[model samples]
Target chain A: MNRNRSVFLLSALVFGFAFLYVPIISMIVFSFNESKLVTVWGGFSVKWYGELFHNRRMLEAAWLSVRIAAVSATCAVIIGTMAGFALARFGHFRTRTLFSGMVTAPLVMPEVITGLSLLLLFVALAPLPFIPDTRGFSTITIAHITLTMSYVAVIVQSRLSSMDDSLEEAALDLGARPWKVFMVITLPIIAPAMISGWLLAFTLSLDDLVIASFTAGPSTNTLPMMIFSTVRRGITPEINALATIMVGIVTIFVITAGVLMARQERRRQLETRGAGR
Target chain B: MANPSYVTLGQRILAGLDKALTTVMASPPYRWSQGILRRAGVTGRTLVIAVPWVWLLIFFLIPFIIVFKISFAETRWLGSPPYAPIWEWVEGHALHVKITFANYLFLLSDSLYVQAFLSSLKVASVSTILCLLLGYPMAYGIARADPSWRNTLLLLVILPFWTSFLLRVYAWMGLLNNHGVINQFLMWTGIIDEPIVMLQTDFAMYIGIVYSYLPFMILPLYSNLEKHDPTLLEAAVDLGCRPFRAFLSITLPLSKPGIIAGSMLVFIPAVGEFVIPRLLGGTDSLMIGRVLWDEYFLNRNWPVASAVAIALLLLLVIPIVIFQRYQLQEASGEQQR
Candidate 1:
């Protein structure tokens, strides 16, 4: 029985891993392929990555995407932190249920609806005041921020709920002003959660194709939108190169963050032990 | 002695000011309306928590109002722009401020829209079921694995997400195309004579959806299943129940929340999925998302598109309500526990 179970598990792992990794491996290998055909293997070359660099449209889109993600993620982090704080700290409020629902609405709400609604909103509200044209960078940033904020709020709120409240109270009792107490105590304590939320929001903004497609104008074509349009035309090696680069960047960041977090935790443990002694 | 008195007097003055501020900040009307956040002082904490409220109200809430507006509007002749209501400039003329339901009428009257909506529901429901079945077994296997190997297995489950979603979906296009890997493998192995019509089929779409959404199902199931008490199963065995029977009665019931959550996570997105269906599914696939896309982008009928979107929202309302209620019930349960 034990042997059979082991065999089953081994097969399952192999199958699962193959399904997960094979396509990615294929794409990565094909990016370096010297031949034009995607499947057929030839001598390896870095021609595709070189080709990717020469593409000005792609480069511009990538720059725009980075700017959008940075702005949106930053705004999302701020908004999400506030919303999370409200949810976690003010749980007894009468409208807590309503607020909570609103916070989570964007997370699971269909992206198409979000896109359509925002598009309509922008068009409708354009005539009202100093809002100006809602078809450019500002609108895209606003949409990204709104969508990304829900994610941040959920992550931060979960962290806050898990943490003990007495720490905040202790800081307050120590004669620190409320602002000083929050900055010194709450912010530092929840900083990791906040950072993770920001990372998540950044990733989401970077990956967003649907909403960006709806909200973006001619000038604000994001990287994913550019890639999508290119792919719609036909398969190209440049996209493969781009995808490979993205995978590399994300892997590096995640690994580095994981190591840093582990080190920080160890340092905290050591400091606490030393203080106890 | 003078310095001590000065310090005491300054401290007293600060305390008095602080109390006065708190009272005003925490006053009933303000507190009742927005809660005790005002009392929390305009610190980073307060700002951090309150800022999203303004953002959500402006960006999130305001957009829905626009959608609601378009849902009632008449379509333009070119279908390029949504209609604004007509008003007479003369005081004696009758005002026609009333909204039209024509856009909604167009949706309800069309068989294509209904078919698409139904197809989306069917696909999402089936894919969700499949994910639960495949995911739960794998989750159980991982949870029961030796502790040392658990993380590795979990990593394997998560490995797919590291790749780009579009790339992953595009990879399916390559694999499911007529002259593709699976067909070639099957033919070379003498399993089939000719290429199977895999691409542009419901089968291919199902495979794509399941493959894409499987990780979501596995993660939740693994978390819930890992928390199962081994002794409960042991006790059931002690009471002379079969292992399978014990699993059915105790384990399955306990993991209901995870199953439901995983299903919702998979099903909700699957319903709104525009990419996979467009890529893999046949022309007859008829998913509402693709229809909505067509209406908005290709047709440029914003009113009709908004109407379609609103209908989709109404369809999702039930699942969303259930999911929200479950979450609330779970939260209060945790509090009680």
Candidate 2:
């Protein structure tokens, strides 16, 4: 709380923010550059945005990524919620340690190893009637579900553990079935965690490049894969335009989520203070 | 009989089925079914546990097994499956299965693979230290800020993470390229006579890794630092301890778990980081992730690639195991409290 310490802290924060945001802001500014060259600043123009709009390949890839992320996030939430419930509620099952370890493994697993192993699994199982023949949308979705569900489970587990369990116990004691208790009482309480988990999964799926690259077929190109391949060739104004649009969309979502969470926290604090009074 | 006549058809069917079920339950063969019926709660819990368990075992654990098995198999040039089967039975005859340790042996014998592994460790370790030094101050700042401003500050820290990671790296490309903004600015300001060669260098790779993984470091540290009781620091001050001394003795020691968790999170993935080194590093930058990619995709050597991956997994297992143990200990410690 000292003045000198505060000054130092403030400067550190400023430097950190600058490090994080400068490149992103520059990219956004250059997206509208009239000059074909990225570094050279010609007068602002919307031509690259037009080019981005007209690029069919980019559009399709982006749309495909959205669909994959959506489906994968939903599936991850459902499975993760179940896993989280088991971890928090079931005291000590037979395979508890193994279950927890498996659920948390993907959090630290390298993308390349994960991608390769999953690819190998799919190929080995391709002969089965239930398994699909080619790696594409479904394969990517399955891989993503495996990847993101671990994150969701961890999030949901922590939320559940910190939550008071009296409401759930009361419901059960009042003759409600366990399933009914969970559905009516626990689900609503854990809904925020579930939503956050879904958002995390969605963004993770959306941002992934390495795993998608390995798992995707020749025909199935996610947006990150497209951007990576294009960037490998060279920087293009079209990419800058695309990236700017992505940044805008993600920023809106993040701000909305942040506002909602902060408001919820404030309300909870007020309620506690009122009770104390 | 009069009651039966008055009864609805649905009620009659239910009554009949109920009677039949009771009759079946009376039989010795159905005793286990009756027990299960009595323990419906256990059944439900079991179902909840079973579904995700089976899914992870199939999709997560089984793949690792497959990778492990493939790593031991021989590479076959002329096969539909690429890798020769570990065990094969020919017509009425069993051919001995040939499992090769050669791929792993090859990895050991070849200096290229060993160098890549060592260099990857070096790069990942150095980047992790840099992230800690940079992240610690920011985390401390956020943790010490006014309560009203803390949420907004944390949100700012996480905002860049939501954007496409590849785009963030690409933005760096535009900045670090010889003809890019950084160079342009220096020339314009008369700081340099010419644009320095910055792209495709170790410096660029470090920047990319640090930029990408900084949030991973800060969030954990912030969570840890935020929970410290302010009274402890005040007590230290009352004891005539210098502020810096208090921080080093009290705050830093308390934040050890956070430091470890964050560093592990950053370090493990950074070791096998394919994208950053590939995009930002030059030809001399032969990180293991890139080596694995080339071995699999470029050289068309599945077995060797699998071996590299398995080796990487083995190297990583020690830290992961240690971290898991720490987590388990912490969880139990909390429960005890």
Candidate 3:
């Protein structure tokens, strides 16, 4: 590309990044504003942060959100890993097309539809003995898993597909059973993918407001639901404070992970290069 | 290798477990069960497929079926399910199927539902185009950036995605509200005499969807662009093709899959978007998702809400199938490569 085109491209990127970050940055900046009005630039204060911590409902909701996210992510990773392994290794089964359809459909299915459908399912099956009559933690968690497992399946499937099979084959050749080979060889190699998938699933579950709103019982108010209800009331500095904390935690975690991964990758490259000589 | 000369504790334990597992598998009872299962063609492969498959069948697939069924049932306000059963056993145990199209008829007769569906489609399509236009250059720049900087740029694109979607939409409220940042800044700069109503408008809703879903667009496009062979561009240049022309002829054509994938990612969800429209758009803005939410929560009309969801799913079937086809093809392409 020409230098002019390159400059234009760089500017476009700058503009895009600015567009993405300015809203978030404004939220962070306003979180510290002492004034009740969000528009006015009152002198900076940490009062909202303090208030956010003391707010028992918000804290409880946050804790509930975390619990739901953790449980859903763990379950999704287990089921999704199995799904991914089957897709990559099982070579076309009898119902492969239908199975694939069910797995991929959720990834793009709109949240409202997923939420409504699940709520309907819960209500429809209410009369059954095994089914819970009241929608609660389990219902919401199951709804989250249906959405998040698709994501995990996609992530793990990609990793498994690109993975070399020589180590697995060699293990099997050396008197190891197929299951043993998988446990020792395949699992470790795909562990990183699974970890990342778990994180993705956890965040998605935590961030969800719509699906949980539909499936949550009267008592099960998650963080996003709380935020949504509060938002409907109007702009509140406490929401800003909460947003700041969430963005801060996620940013720190992601950057630290990225840096560590990059360093490890570079070291591996260096080792390989050194051994090549 | 277990390295017999120097067996580590980990290796020893692994070996011991493997041996124990093999012994257990060889035992008569285990062998008998295995033989029976094998004779029935129920192997580990089938077992792996059974779990996630059955889970999706119940939770994902079956829920949609229930939604469809509920949509056909009449509303009954005084029950756990505020909708009447689609079928019920009455005297003598003969099968009874009571399927009503009343909900669907209500949807069709009222222009509101139809208008909401159309408006949602329009909004989703327009926002998808906006995302593509805005995201393409950013993806290209990052894809062509120095190797060392690529990861950071890509991370920057995806970082917003990891944050709360609701929070991001909420953050935009701080920017676009009447007295929000943009209006304040514009008024201060003398760009306008009065605060232009930025929030609670179609424009604000567009901004919300594009801002929220842009990462989804860029990531796929960037991954596709990043894999394009640089040598091809060099060759085109050597052959005296103009820079922009080369981009159009070589780069754009090559990234069709990415474009489709990214567009589907944005478009599919944007159609049923509730929070963005309800939170950002005016009360006048009609989206199927918001309409459905209102139907269920405000009106306490479960059958109507179910009908709306069924309609939205029907609308989405085409795009969802396209996306599935693309993903499967992409997977196969990767394996072939």
> What lDDT would each prediction earn against the true structure?
0.78, 0.89, 0.90
| Candidate 2: stretches off by over 4 Å | A271-277, B1-42, B329-337
DockQ metric, candidate 3: 0.66
User: Across residues B241-296, which tens digit of lDDT does each residue of candidate 1 receive?
Assistant: 87777878999999998898788778887898887887778877898888998888
Instruction: Say which prediction, candidate 1 or candidate 2, comes out ahead on lDDT.
Output: 2
* Tens-digit lDDT string for candidate 2 (A1-277): 4677789888989999999999999999999999998889999899999999999999999999999999999999999999988988788989899999998889989999999999998899999997879889999999999999988888887777777688899988899878667755677568789889999999999989989988887788998998999999878999999989999998999899888777766766776676678
Worst 10 residues of 3 chain A by lDDT: A263-272
Please report how far candidate 1 places residue A138 from its true position, in Å.
1.5
Which has the higher TM-score value, candidate number 1 or candidate number 3? 3
Q: Candidate 3's residue-wise lDDT over B1-337, tens digit each? A: 3224444454466667767987898899999999999999998877888999899988988888888888899999887567788778889978788999999999999999999999999999999999999999999999999998999999999899999999999998889988999989999999998999988999999999999999999998998999999899889999999988999999999999999999999999999999999899998999999999999888889889989998998899899999999999977777676
Candidate 1 root-mean-square deviation in Å? 7.1
lDDT of 1 by residue, A50-78 (tens): 99999999999889888998999998888
Per-residue alpha-carbon lDDT of model 2 for B264-290, expressed as tens digits?
888999999999998899978989999
The pairs that clash in candidate 3 are none
- Give the TM-score comparing model 2 with the true structure, all chains together: 0.92
Better of 2 and 3 by lDDT: 3
The top-ranked prediction according to TM-score is 3
Candidate 1 CAPRI assessment class: acceptable
